[model samples]
Target: MIQSCLTIRGHLSKSLTTAKLINIRHAHSGIIDPLQLKPLQQEGGLLDKLISAIRRRSAPAVWKAYTDLKDSGKIKEVPIQYHSMTLQSFRLNENGYYSSDKLKFYKKCISDILVATKKAQYKLDVRDYNVLLRLYGQSRDWKAASDCWNEIKVKKNEESYNLYMQAAVQCKKYDEVFKIFNKMNNDGIQPDVTTYNTLIEANGRMGNVTEADKLFRDYFAPKNTENKSTSIISKYFIKDANLSTYTPSAAPLSRCIPPPNAVLSPTTDTFEALIDAHGRKKNTPGLNYIYKTMLPQYDIKPDLKIYNALIRWYCHSGDIEAARNTFVDMEASGIKPNVAVFNHLFRHEALKRNRPKVAEAIIDYMRKEYGIRPSTSMYATLIRIHNKHNREDEANRLHTIYKALKSKKLEEQ
Candidate 1:
């Protein structure tokens, strides 16, 4: 059934491409000029074609459509929005990684748009700045993200602060994370779930478990009567355990009651951050409470990331039994274990625990049961383990396999 649907979609796409080519040929032949074409906003018109091309990530098609619209002299109708869409289209690569060349192109396009809009007296909206900020965040250019934030001429929304904070967190600017949050509050902008998640992660990385815990308790976790007296914003900003000197205006406090649409419940990412924080601190009781109690009470099912965190923590703490039990629970929950999960167990048994046989059994189980292959780093560690144990023959064997896999990967590339 899926194949049939795919076949039909292929035919439709081919038909659409043919139609576009025919239209272009007619335009080039002077059979139909730009003015003779249908209105730009009509169905299947130049604007729709350009938008479709952008959505498809076909740079060539987008350029062609854009050139046609430009020749039609209709691009001035809504130039900034069209430029914003074009900029957004170049934000990511096919593999979902940021490309430097794409980012450079995006910057150039943005520069050109800014110049054109300035001469036309067109003001750039918050969406354009938000897109630029998001691209900078993905590229890990926090400095550029800050510059973009400063360049926002219009009012900043929740997303603007969220993206800026995300970039800050990615660059390990933990102090800036809170500063942005405080600035966001001072601006009378309320944070959403993503904001709280980024704050939690930043605090977690900074080893400020208390701050992260407070954020979760105040904003994300389910609220009770005792915690309901103080509003969410006041609890974090005015009465925080840290940041004593941040005294913002009283205007924001009056608007602290979250709207009905506000997301106040914890998400999986919130739990993940809390789990990782406790794990890094070796706070077993904290991990126990989150994994065994809070998650169940909240009815939030553990995903692969959650299980991986548990396995990593157990492995780090030298509790192979607990790690194995977590792995078993993961499988029982019908969650497929990835190579990272096996890597944790393998590294623990082979290197730290000095049980190469147990590690070998794990690799065997991974391959036979799940058809999972060990990553190159895993092979390197296994090789080291075998060599340390004086198993020279096994070490050489694994070395040869690793080399072959590496060569194969390079050849494919």
Candidate 2:
């Protein structure tokens, strides 16, 4: 199943590349002289630079770029996109974690932006509100997200609902997720892949494995001739079968046929949610089935997150061999394992498995092979492990290294 899936996906990927090249050729068939183009305004150029900084996800860079543009005296008014992109820059760190200091800073930034928008008499549009919703969601500030939703109630679209649902999920307000989903249906908004992914994640995190499985099965693996009650005709569609549901605003599944341009397939995130659900329940067979059979069957390749989850599950289940094997497979598939992956394996080896040597070897391998610096906490763990094994010299050595690294980090900051 894995080979077949990879083969099919490779073919489709090549076809896409070919089509892109053809489109590029067609686009350049009539070359326009650069002299014929209108000169970009200084304000526009500054805005582009600010946007570039925002895309880099550097808070200081974003602020400097914005300040430069604002001080240039060419700006008539602040664009809503600037505010939105600025908010997006405060997203969680790469490890999917945030600090209180960051959240407080984000709140202050939002307050300043709101004041500026009011002074400029700029009305916040749905898109701006959606960005706010996303920012609040990432910060796990559900109340703030709710406020944004209320402000955009009249203009709430699919993205608005999806972001709000994500916020509720992040805050562990699982019940609110369902309520918002029901409201979305009643409001005639069709759920897209992101919406379904959030619902699945909410269900999975809440330990509603059955519901998560039902959603995946109904939406991604429906039988050809099966009659479903809850399907809608929209610009998006699911593969193999239509999404089966009976929302108040949706037509019968049997009667709804998608347009030719409609195509919605289960994404890598969809399977990640399922794997998480099974892992939460320790349903080994179910998790393996999703990773080995279902994902390949759907032509969805496993990403780094999926592999991380797999390793975590195996470690939690005391299957060290399996966890190590998954790591090997992840590397073989050309997915660069991140710090989280190494942390999982290292923790399991040093503490749970009581293989201090193996754990230290893993850390060394990570540093040498992937150039990943071990977190201070990992050093703490190693210190404890060495102490437990009556290796005071080793413990003291690691302690010195940890202190130096911590002090260096603080100084750099």
| CA lDDT, every model vs. true structure | 0.67, 0.67
**Model 1, runs deviating above 4 Å:** 1-53, 57-83, 90-125, 222-263, 388-390
Predict model 1's lDDT versus the native: 0.67
lDDT of 1 by residue, 1-413 (tens): 00010011111121234345344433442111212222345433778787677657666566667667667876665433355445444444312444467667566665555665665454455655666777777667778888888878777788788878888877777778777877887898977888788877876677656656766766665555326554322222222245232224212322542433433878788788888766766666677678888899778999988999988987887777878888999999999998889999998888897877788788889989999876677778889888887999999998998999788866964
Candidate that scores best on TM-score:
2
Clashing pairs for model 2 are: 230-245, 230-246, 237-264
Tens-digit per-residue lDDT, 1-413, candidate 2: 00010011111111234345334323542211212223234446776666566646677777677667658864444443345445445444323555667677767777676775665454555545766776788778888888778777446778788878888988888778877877887788888888778877877787656657656656666355233433221112122243233333222322331322334588888888887877776666676677777788778888888999998887877777878888989999999998889988998888887888889899999999999888898899989988988999999999999999899878976
TM-score per model over all chains: 0.66, 0.73
